[model samples]
Target: MESLHGKVVLITGASSGIGRAAAELLSSKGAKIIVNYLSNKKGAIETVQRIQKNGGDAIIIQADVTIKEQVNAMVEQALASFGKIDILINNAAGGIRQSTFMDASEELWEETYRLNINSVLLCSQAVLTHMIPRKEGKIINISSTAARIGGAGESIHYAASKGALNTMTIGMAKELIEYGIIVNGIAPGMVETPFHEKFAPNEDRLSRMSATIPIKRVAQPIEIAETIAFLASDASNYILGEIINVSGGR
Candidate 1:
């Protein structure tokens, strides 16, 4: 992959999982990373430390993507620090717990949409102000396999949220293409992140869930990060508005 040296990349949810991995990987390739974390200060700091240890430039910022003011401040901070925003990885998301459609409450559904879909829209809109003038940018939305194949035990609301993200990616890609901003998405399947521990809770059930995948294993965070780095780099210039499934062939 081509180096992202000198590029300013903003990644939400950089406290852990695929977001953290992507921050480290992209920074290693010379991209200046803005590590945005919602609450995991320690994890986010460690992510920055890892990048700095490897001679990469990175800074940690705290923000709740679902909040418009926080999202605006995050983009402003990134631009203030880097002077330009080259890429955005909308990886921050919430509401991973499983719930049936009938059982899911209105609050749960609204929260899912707020975090997953609304955040993407807010962040993308914030970044566009800077990107449009420059006439160049890359926006990568982190979706999930649930959006493609509906989650069986999980709330339909979560799937609907991600489905909305996929739709936004397609629509934004078409709208932003004219301004040279490429929008794309990455849908991962059963990645071994702290998210599973929080969502599944039961170790035995999690193991059973892992067994269903064709690969017979869950993906490591770096596995998904590698794909995001590729999409953010020059190598994926021709790829826009497409959702790349990182499901281990499931």
Candidate 2:
């Protein structure tokens, strides 16, 4: 990726799981990474250390994307350090806890929407202020297949949140393209990451999930990260406002 060399990519929730994978892979391809973490300071530090160890340029910043103030501060700091943000990856989201619709609490739904959808709104708005002026930027969001399936399980709120994100991606893509900002999303299938640990912790459950996929396996974090990389790069120039599914044929 000749174009990726020295590009500045800010990745939210970058301390672990898919976020960490994107940060590491983008940095490996010579992109300068702004690794943002909300609560996992240890994981954030490890991500930075790994990038530095591999001779990649990176810096770690902690900010809860769900909060407007924190999101503002994080984007400001990135610009202060890097002068500009070329890519924005909205990956800061969670299911919070798994529970049936009847079992889901009002508080759980609110928090899930805050973390999953609100963060995307807040982060993209903050980054767009600068991107619009430059007339060039890439915003890649992490969505889920559940958005289409409607999460028959306890992840109804989670799926709903991502569904909102997917719609926003399409709208933003069309709205931002005239300004040279490309907004797209990736809907990854089951992946081997801490996400599953939080969502489906049991080994047998994971096995059952994997067996159900057409690939007979879950995705590795890097597999999803690699897709994000393509979306951020020049290779994705014509792909606007589309949600590309990376679900291993699921």
Candidate 3:
């Protein structure tokens, strides 16, 4: 944990959920955080405020990760505040309303790919310019267990996007290792986050999902963030190109 001292981490969708948790945890571990948000300004600001109140450093920037221009600008803003980018966490992604692939619209497919997969590419490409020359950096992309379970009838498209991300992690890791950049991913199962509150609002939905897992529970955002802390540190330097499943053994 202390291995992150004085490092700079840029996390997308950092206004809430796992992204926000990673932001707070990394800051607490002595890394300066650049909180990236698309539309949740209030949540982003509060994340920064909480970090500062705890004697940690953080800055917030608003940008739609799906857009190349906006994604590039976000990286610029981070460099403006902190001269270098030490970590890049691709956590900005979402699924459309529940639907089978046959019922899914082309627009839904495009939107899902844009945010979940394209954003990862754009941000990683932009950050490499800074990371390559330094010969050291960590790029942790967030995947999902849906990639393995094929979305469990929720949305096949969401699964496809994460599957692509997991593949990208492996490809990027091989390409970037000579430069000292470690590329990896985390595929989380059901987690307690605003995402569930909005998408699975049933009083017993989490319980129902928990029943399927050996652990009998969904994850807390901070629990995922703890794994993120490990991947972001030198201690995990040896674990490259692998997506560590934080799915309670699902």
Q: After superposition, how far is residue 230 of candidate 1 from its true place, in Å?
A: 0.8
For model 2, the run of ten residues with the poorest summed lDDT: 1-10
Query: Looking at model 1, how many pairs of residues clash?
Result: 0
lDDT of 1 at 90: 96
Per-residue CA lDDT of model 1 for 5-107, tens digit only, reads: 8999999999999999999999988899999998899999999999999989999989988898998998998899999989999999866567878889888
Encode model 3's per-residue lDDT on 123-168: one tens digit a residue: 9999998999999999999999999999866679989999999999
Tens digits of lDDT, candidate 2, 124-243: 999999999999999999999999988736889999999999999999999999998999999999988888887888899889878878989999999999999999889989999999
Model 2, CA-based lDDT: 0.92
Q: Over the full model, what C-alpha lDDT does candidate 1 score relative to the true structure?
A: 0.90
For each candidate in the order shown, give its overall lDDT on alpha carbons.
Answer: 0.90, 0.92, 0.92
Give the higher-lDDT candidate: 1 or 2.
Answer: 2
Angstrom error of the Cα, residue 239, model 3: value is 1.1
TM-score of each: 0.97, 0.97, 0.97
